[model samples]
Target: MSHNINGKAAGKFAAVEQEFAKNFAERGEVGASVCVSVGGETVVDLWGGTADPATETPWERDTVSIVFSCTKAATALCAHILVDCGLLKLHAPVSEYWPEFAKNGKELTTVQMMLNHESAIPAQREPIRPGGFLDWDYMIQRMEDEEAFWEPGTRNGYHMVNFGWTVGELVRRVSGKSLGTFFRDEVASLLSAEFWIGIPDDFSQPIAPIIPFVPDPKMELSPFTKKLLTEPQSIQALSFLNNGGWTPNDPEAHKAEIGGAGGIANARGQVAMYEPLANGGSINGVTLVSAARLAEMGKVSTATQIDATLLAPTRFASGFMKSMDNRAYPGGDQMSAVLGEAAFGHVGAGGSIGFADPDHDLAFSYTMNKMGAGLLLNDRGQSLIDATYAALRA
Candidate 1:
């Protein structure tokens, strides 16, 4: 467990640095970074350990990681921007933009339903061809043709994989640009954020390869995990695993904008995106949305519903996940990311998280190479969160 955990924190935030080191010392963190910003100013930025465990390459200050569903936050931001521009409406039917989405009983599905995971088209019934994830048109076409798993607004399910394409396509149809391109030109480039919805083939960032978790010998699967693992046809499994249940480790595949899962950023870059949302909807003189829209984005849209996909009580606000203390968070382990009731953000699989607590004017992000089991914040990331909030109160 001997590794160099490198980074610095401002005077009041030394505890975040200590917790970042403890992740490696006590929580099996092979390589990771945690970043926090208050009032849009970075107070903590840290990175350490091996980018490639196999190669033992040091995780440098600029090292990035593939943040799975955390990409949803970035994708969701695009939709919100379109809403701000009046090109998309949250309550409008999907047919308002993408007519194809209206097929197979989805005529009543609204943009809000897609954002909050209530669209009931969590997974495609049509078999995904090998490499279907790389084919944006094919994936969306399948979703367009499939029947809703339930009536659009009746059930709340985490749309594990389809979220990107479903919502991404909505952004595309309205903005006249693909989600990745819109994110680059309008969001990332605008904020000078290093986040990428899709990693280009020739991109130069040093991306840490994700190391899959090794199961603990003494640990047993919870009922939720057991269902997802043993029941291949279950909505949870089908939504996540049916399309090969694989994440692209190479640059080419990473270039595909999967929306829900395909996002690449260091903690700093992720925080940059949230910083604007946290700070009256502007950063560095750029406004992504107005204060009015920011408040709307933070309003709770779904709460304590037993999610059909994750089979847990989950909360979401608009396209953002709410910081709820009562439910077992999405990944079958732990409580929510500690934040103000007014906070919102998204968590990726294996411990990456990006969130904004507008009440505190705070934005936080954590990324790691070593995969942790479950969907919510693991100790490695959660410790950093706890320390960040503690620093805020001080």
Candidate 2:
């Protein structure tokens, strides 16, 4: 278990580094990196362990991985930028931009409804072909024809794979740019961060293949987890698997922009991407949104409701997940995040996460190669946040 942990920690944030290291030795971290910024300044940037467990490739400073749902935050930002430019309206019916979407009782579906997972198109009527994810037109056509699982804008559910297309198409119609291009040109390039919605054909970078974690055979699943596992036909199951059932090993996947789950980034990349949100919608003199627009976009517009797909009480403002006042876990089983109420961002499946804690002027990101079982912040990531805040408070 002897591995060299790379990167530096500010003297005040030394405890954060300790916890990050502890995850490798004590917890089951195979490869991971954590970056935290305060007042738009990076105070902690750390990476360690093996990048490829099979090849025993040492994790380099630039190693990145597929950050799952954390990609949603980037997609959400694209919409907010358009909103800031007055090019898109939150309350306008989506049919205003894409006429075909108005059919099937969806005439009333608004941009905001889609943003908050209330549009009710949570699952595909028929599972898309394995490679259909790369076909933007094919996917959007499927969405247009699919029936809403519930009345649009009436109930909340985790959109899982669908959120990206719902929002990405809107970005396309209004911005005249694909979500990947828009994000790269507007956000990533300006910030000088290495993040990609779809890993470009010519782009080359060191990316770790996600290593699935195997649990002890004797371990029993909670009732909720058991149901989600056993129900193949349920919305919960379809939400994740309908689109080719993603894996980091798929080289072609990097070339497709599945915004809901297909983001590629290092921990530093995520921190940089969120730093603007932590610093009033701009970083380094590059303005993506006005202060007024930021205030409106960051406000919680959805009622605190349980997600039908995730089966957890959740809250969202615009497109980012707001900290829940109640537990986000099943039966109040676990805390969804360790940040403050003012925090907003997203967690990727398998424990990667990135967020902006405006209350503390902090933006944090954790990315890893090893996948863990959980719908929220796993202890490995939570411990780093707990230590960072504890050090700050002390």
Candidate 3:
């Protein structure tokens, strides 16, 4: 299957582009795009392969798909921007903005605590209402009624999907707009980034539907998956399988602001979105935060030996993921996302990712329709990250 790869790779980045195309040959990439920007310049911008393998639809430059948790980075950016504007304080309790959040042992939950996964609203223990994700009020009410998994701020837990409503609700309360609208009117609109937290009903663009992950039958279950299957009452099970009848492939899901796990973007769109953060918080006169705030955005705020929910080592910088080097740990290489030491971003399920490395003045993204095994960056996306860094050093 010699799929056509279209786009440009300037200078040394040509090698990076080659690696992107090679993914189809050596790796199991079904359809994907990789984009890179260095020192505020787009040195590599490429998209290729099929968008819908079932229909044989060519993966055009504009093709987009669900970026899953990568959407967390965008949601976090909206919160931090409010911090930069003095509209919200990082140290302020979430109750300051939404008083209802103060109950259920969350009275002291600070904005930073929520962003760093230290506030303990990791997931709802009971089942959510069917398709409750689409109803903002329903989700918020559930959050209010939910109890903390542990003493808030005592342990770190990857908030997973709930991050959207926990932090996103704060964005809405402070900014007086929905999470998707705030991100668009303030962030995406500024950079002309095509990424969207929630697509509107009138949105006519064709979205590359998500291909669900299929695990190998021969593969051994991880501690997380094993626990999820055996202990259905555990947090791990609740965090994953308890979604309110939402499927990524559904058009209605695309139109809802599931900011934690539902974002639609291509590599170019993600790269463009992170461009300003890599370039000192402003580009083309579109400023997201000041240089000082950008510094805070990239700094690691929490490190845990085993995240309470994911049951794995994790590091978080506010709402973003810092460069995670878990390669030395047992089977950690498969779940690690290694970027520049100062880089901060998020990886979605099935290996889509976007990040900004301020130390290198670089922004990068890889979006794909096909699913990959593992909880983090698979070889398909990590290879591109390595190739991009190699090109940068050249």
* lDDT top scorer: 3
lDDT of 3 by residue, 1-394 (tens): 5478999999988888888878988887778989999878889989888888889888888889999999999999999999999999999888899999888888888999999998888889889889998888999998888988887888899888999999999999999999999999998888889899999889876688888878888865666777888998888888888889989998999999998999899998899889999999988788889999999899989999888987778999999998777777666766689899999999998899999998889999999998887778888999999999998898
Considering every candidate listed, which one attains the maximal TM-score? 3
Better of 1 and 3 by lDDT: 3
Candidate 1, residues 279-330, lDDT tens digits: the string is: 9999889999999999999998986556787766788988888875533433
- List candidate 1 stretches off by more than 4 Å: 326-332
- Cα RMSD for candidates in order: 1.8, 1.8, 1.1
Candidate structures ordered by lDDT, highest first: 3, 1, 2
Point out where model 2 deviates above 4 Å.
217-224, 325-335
Error of 2 at 271 (Å): 1.0
Per-residue error for 189 in candidate 3, Å, reads 0.9
Clash pairs (backbone) in predicted model 1 = 164-260, 331-375
TM-score, each model?
A: 0.96, 0.95, 0.98
Ranking by TM-score: 3, 1, 2
TM-score of 1: 0.96
Query: Which digits, one per residue and each the tens of the lDDT, describe model 2 over residues 1-394?
Result: 4567999999899998999989998888988999999998889999999988778898889999999899999999999999888899999999888888877777789999999998888888686887888788888998899888888888888888789999999999999999999999999999988799998888778889998767666654533356568987788777766765556678888878988888999999999988988888788898878878777766777855457887666778888877653443343423366577788898888788898876788899999988876666777988897898897688
* lDDT for residue 78 in candidate 3, whole number 0-100: 95
